[model samples]
Target: MSITLFRTLEMLRHVPREPRKITTSELRDRLAAANFDVTLRTIQRDLQKLSTVFPLISDERDHVFGWSWSRDAQVETLPGMDAATAITFAMAEEYLRDMLPSGVLELLAPHFDQARRVLDATDNGLNTWKRKVRVLPRSQPLIAPDVDPEIAQSVYDALLNDRRLKAVYRPRGREPREYDLSPQGLAFRDAVTYLVASHRDYDNVLMFALHRFLHADVTDEPARHLPGFDFDEWVQRGGFDADRHGEAIQLVAQFDMAVGDHLHETPIADDQHLARTDDDRLELIANVKDTHQLRWWLRGFGPDVEVIEPAEIRDWLIEGARQQISRYADASSGR
Candidate 1:
């Protein structure tokens, strides 16, 4: 394919599926707007080539055109692998990055290779492209830094198979303990990942952070799904307010106006609502799961922020500040 043809198809990728119809003149207008400088004839030839190789459906009489994908069409269309599968894997890689386990990537590597080969056969620049399209910085990972890959794989496999697991866990500041658990769900919270399960020892639902486990062993014991323990309800009750369960609580914090712009641009919450107070303070509302998590987040702002609501939360912040002040004074006194 010519560079012009490749560029045109790439542009079409951005167009929505429902509004798949585009007239020749509309296509030309779009190309011209994009500074492509291509003629109508070139666009027609490009569309024809795309239709033959891919799934570009058109109604000539109605002057309407759109793109759709079929399972068989996807399998047969790729110069080697279909566009859909290739795009899916590429997009997944872009989003998941280090969040995915190495074992999962190994399983996906072959499929990704097939897609790359197909793109290479097209002789498009995609084959030789080494552009840095996306960049994700290395920060402290959400999960524990030293979680054993083998143990992670075992838990993941158990989750996939709906199997029960027996494990020895050593909670922070606690002794090692063993339990037989029915794994109900898994979640990543406050930079930690946890397995929510029904514990035989407690006879209640409990969350065990994956990183805290000393050992995780899958058992042939029959999996038991808990009754009246709706995952969604349990999550919400735990103050997570998440869609399925453990819903996060919405928290609002007011900050001194000096750093309002900085806070607005670099939000501390995944979802934040910002407002300017009459007293020149910036109020930010965000969803958080636990008071401890919120306190830690607020501590990052030092004196610039103040907890605005949830009286208990505000008190906790005050107490944390007092503790820090005491520690500073004691350190100064060399005690």
Candidate 2:
């Protein structure tokens, strides 16, 4: 595609449908991010010229008005989506829609619609693929918390452009506080999304839950990065692990035959050993991380699994069982 056409197509994508709008300056900045490097006057002219051919409108009610696509515009994406691409987009739209930030999801709405159209037009077996697929949650489903779309948009923009972000964050069980964040990466864990970032000039990083952000805006200042920092390595090192103890531990446990049957095929760790015991139980030995998730998983197999080694874990389980029994007893006695 020609440079003008490419820039125009990208600009159109950035211009949200009414009643959402984008100012000329904002469009210029976004275009610059995509390496368009056009002047504000040039952006205004391009929008005015493109408006004649496309369903685009400029809101001139105010001194500094913005542009938007007409509410009913059926804009098709360039280099049309193929059947395979359509199916992939369809799957993502169905399965991962709720997990994405609202702002990001909104940006994908056009592609999702295009995917639906492409799939609908197809008369082949691929059209039925979406129906055949299934994604099941392992645990009981929890409703995803609401995240402010504007805040999410700002964070995304900042991260994409490697710019600093300013956000008003509300910590759990605490008052809201504003902070300057240098975003490193984003983590989508289960239902919640977290922004891994550093505060001000700090070298150490922290996680800010997207739902907990009251407000956010990106700044022009460049984001600071820790020297030789690797996001993947950080994840492997248990940066996001809750209630984490130092390193890996030798986990020795016993499980009832019925409960531990699946472990024979799907071991907990690479070095896991599972064998049938003389008493018809299953013995499990593995080296695993000591994390809150580990504890939760172990506790979930109540009465079906026993921690044979790791004195602290064993004692913790015993105390938890005792408390649970005591609570039931108290309830029975109307305490």
TM-score of each: 0.55, 0.89
Q: All models: lDDT?
A: 0.64, 0.87
Which predicted model would earn the best lDDT? 2
Worst 10 residues of 1 by lDDT: 69-78
What lDDT tens digits, residue by residue, belong to model 2 across residues 1-335? 69998998888889977656889899998899899989989889988998999999988888869999886676475677899999999999888766776666766777788888899999998999999998877676565687876777788879998999998999999999999999999999877889999999999889999999998988889999988888888887788884473368999999999989999888899999998999999999999987777888999999999999899899999999999999999999995
Tell me how candidate 1 scores on lDDT.
Answer: 0.64
Ten consecutive residues with minimal summed lDDT in candidate 2? 238-247
Best-fitting candidate, measured by TM-score? 2
lDDT of 1 at 301: 76
